[model samples]
Target: MPALPDPLPDPVAPVVPLGQDPGRAAADRLLGQELRRCREARGLTLRQVAPVIRGSVSKISRLERGESPPRPRDVRALAAFYEVDAQQMRVIERLLEHAQDAEWYEQFSDVTPGFLKRLIQLEGDAEEICVYENLVVPGILQTRAYARHMVRAVMPSAEPEEVDRVVELRAERQLRLMDGPLPRVVALLEESILHRRCGDAQVMHEQLKHLLHAGDTDKVSIRILKMSREWGVTPPYPITHLKFSNGEQSELAYVEHINGANYVTKPRALDDYRNALSNLRNAAASKDESIDLILKAQHRFGDRTAS
Candidate 1:
């Protein structure tokens, strides 16, 4: 079995909380209901709640509705008003943080969307992730040069300043795999990812070197499927699976076109994607041999560059 994560450290990072957009939305609803229960159980009406904290009825209602966050002071006031201790208030506080996550991913609003937040949550909470790619070393394994090239290419029409900012964000997304507290990441790459040229020889070489580094790591595993293999279930899409330590499972799927991304969790859709993933995994080379294939391609390209 893979190494399990250490006991969660009070879980107070305030980073992306443990919910996707829909998950957060539901959490918000529950927090709202709980807030009302706490207040009503103490015989406090909306009017009494407002004056007790010197806020408006509208403000109290808004907090209960999760339309706005409960300020720290507001939480203190309410806890006192409800005759509860600070520890009891913690549950509400944590749930509201999930409501505030900017990481609610959009399918494709472009402009770098929310990759950093999504990446952090996926690594911090997940036990394992299985990823498939068609034409790149997935972001977790990308070198700076390769990442910059891919970022520049991702949104070709963005303003110059916006492009630069996004490239910086992509480069930052590689932290976990390089350092500690990483997830068990298994990747399957199509053979053509090797031959496709994203940048000049220098950047491409960096990418290949980075892939080798990833393969050599004890926990990170990668496999490549040769182009000649006749694979049966083609979803014509890219898919990723993330299994969290909390028993939460999600599929990160995107359309074949650039900029199309969706965190797929509808049961029926997940079933179809899971079937496709199982087939693709079966067709790919094992980690040991995949590294050899990648190294050979690197040598061939390097020879061409040297001559």
Candidate 2:
């Protein structure tokens, strides 16, 4: 029988290198995904990769799932073991460099659930984000007062401090809409959602005003689905579609449920959500019409306060 190729010498976890600054959670995730693909492609399992990387199976699993960052030397060792060429080697190195940075949201780790952490990671790197809101305004476009009302309403039993923390976290996320290279946001809001009394009539009015201002920006497009329209089926879930521009340029659909969230990656499922979003866009009011509707709703809310 022909001799089998020898595996590369066992590796030690290299001194983890750091990036320019924090906020590399997204990069770490992308790198982990690439590592998993390489491992699976070469018919290797977590158990097999652990020894080579000088880690346990769980550690390898975490690295593969982007649950943890990977060391540069560990990445190099895996590349060599997989017989990756010079070009691929460089790619791995690039990913390792990206994976080294800390996440900005790490401070909220105590309050943030793992599922939400994953969502935030994806949100950080998304080039475009599409959100469908059935009840309230999408969090990314919400004003502080509106978001605070939402937090209080949803978690009525939560401590005041916790609610405040949640509101603060939401505010931080909203900054993404303008702070840096903005993610183009396409938000579909049900018409009745504007009328749903959150904090008070004044609160709703102020929120609508905020929405109007946000919609005016070139990066945001808000559309309202009228109540009278014969919309087919109500969306079974709130959908968030994230589109990325760099690396593999992956597209993901985040479906939120009562307890947790589901990430849709299968092509067919993704297509379904994509098509639904397209249909919703067509059925909703145009940009100008949406702005007009929002203005009308704001006036109505203001009227309630006057009376």
Candidate 3:
């Protein structure tokens, strides 16, 4: 009935690492998604909502995309404009508080890349992680030595200190993976990865042994995809599928390449990845057979080290 006050300018927020406050980041995304859904259901556009919230179209867009921290006043204005029920309003209020909470990864923001920060955050929140790797071992399952070698290979120009920081970050992620009972992980490694040497014989041996031990855990499953002529189709790039606890925005598909990565949220694209994962699972060796394969690879590396 009355015009809302103009939205206040957002402060220049610090560059906090994405993983620093995964819970908050997740809340921001979920809240934005809910706002966007409500707007679409009302057949309203960002331009229409902007004036009611006393903000620009871009500002409204940013709010709906969760790119910026939400203002309580703006959120209240939006809720009133949308005429949401009391129950829905309560949910929004809770999300707003969670989104504004302090994060843990703030200290590492200076060293971590934005994409990596986001990935780590997603991994942290994911209820289940499905990895399809054709290159080196997935970061979550890598041993410290293996991680160091891979980091050096990927970031050759990085300073020694920076490289150590990256390795430490990877180790921290692995520790987080083991710390709680939240994320159940399934890793599919191409058979060739076993032969692809990341470092010297000792490194590869330790890495393979680590995978063997990890596979024994109830929370982790590791399978090997053997090279075969009968295998019809395979995904061209590495894919990490993350399923979260939230019902509204439950799943995310991460496709990574040499230069950057793409986060796939579209239902159709996610379905495609799901199908590819199914095919890969069918083509891959069973867990026991995969373990044997890993053991053999470890022995080969062990023999080389002993020589």
Candidate 4:
């Protein structure tokens, strides 16, 4: 991976409460939404704004869709072009500032992929996170040993230092989410995850125990999806749906694949993931039942370790 530019220092601003930095990605999306609204309200199109910003139509579109970070000059130009009021410009400026601020995950850019970095930024800004996993426990719910083992298994070629950095990144992300009051997390795990051993029996036992403890929290919900013919097909890849504090932008659905991930924002696509999550929830065990299942799995692993 090429070297990434160092993130800008955090600007001195009012301290935001935990789990609420409006995150770089979320801020970009919010700014893009505002810019798009301004254009539409003025009966303008991307073509008209492209020239004003000295960019292409696609560039304007990317800005409007929050695909790229907004440049201050371009934002100012567009604000002037749209003749937005002082208050609106202030809001735009604030969003721009937030968007430019470095994300927490930037420190791990060497180990983190671009798509995963975006997900981490969104996670920080989300008010609620819904996760569905079939392969293994979600990163936020994984114990350190489990995380280390999983990382090594997945990235067989990674150096020891790189592996440690990746595991450290996961630990930091887990800490930020679990140590906060905001960003409620609901995770759905396929029962196979419990049976699929990532490491030694001891590691699996410890991981299951950690899941039980996480599920006991007020802000976290963990449910086990059982393997039954009645439930039909399950999503092949992992799905993460993030609902942000800003109500203006729509919810985002993330699908992770081997190479990269897709961010779903279109209503129809998002609805499909939402429906899948809802159906899985209905088919899965309740919280209490899930706890029982996890306990059983933990004991199974514990017995193996004891032997």
Q: Tell me the tens digit of each residue's lDDT in model 2 across 11-89.
A: 2211122223234666677788888878888999888888997889999888877787677888788888888778877
Q: 1-307, model 4: which lDDT tens digit per residue? A: 1221112211222123224555556789999999999989999989888999889999999998889878999999999999999999988987886686446677888888877776776676688999999899999999999999999999999899999999999998898787557789999999999989989989999899889889999999999998753746777778888888765664877777777767777666667778878887788899998999898988888765443
RMSD, every candidate, angstroms: 11.0, 15.5, 15.1, 14.4
Candidate 4 TM-score to native: 0.67
Candidate 2: Cα lDDT at 198: 86
lDDT accuracy of residue 28 in candidate 3: 83
Off by over 4 Å in 2: 1-102, 303-307
**Cα error of candidate 1 at position 117, Å:** 4.6
| Best lDDT among the predictions, by candidate number | 4
Q: Give per-model TM-scores.
A: 0.59, 0.67, 0.67, 0.67
Candidate 4 achieves a global lDDT of 0.81
lDDT of 1 by residue, 1-307 (tens): 1221121111122224334355555666777777888998888799988887788999889878877655656766677778866776777666655454334333223644444356555554466778888767787777777777787786677787776666555555456344443468788888888878878876777688778887788777888998877855344445667666654444443322344345555565555566666777888988777888888878756754453
Which prediction has more favorable TM-score, 1 or 2? 2
Candidate 3: clashing residue pairs, number: 1
How should the candidates be ordered by lDDT, best one leading?
A: 4, 3, 2, 1
Residue 142, candidate 1: how far off, in angstroms? 1.7
lDDT of each: 0.65, 0.76, 0.78, 0.81
Better of 1 and 4 by TM-score: 4
Candidate 2 global TM-score:
0.67
Give the winner by TM-score: 1 or 3: 3
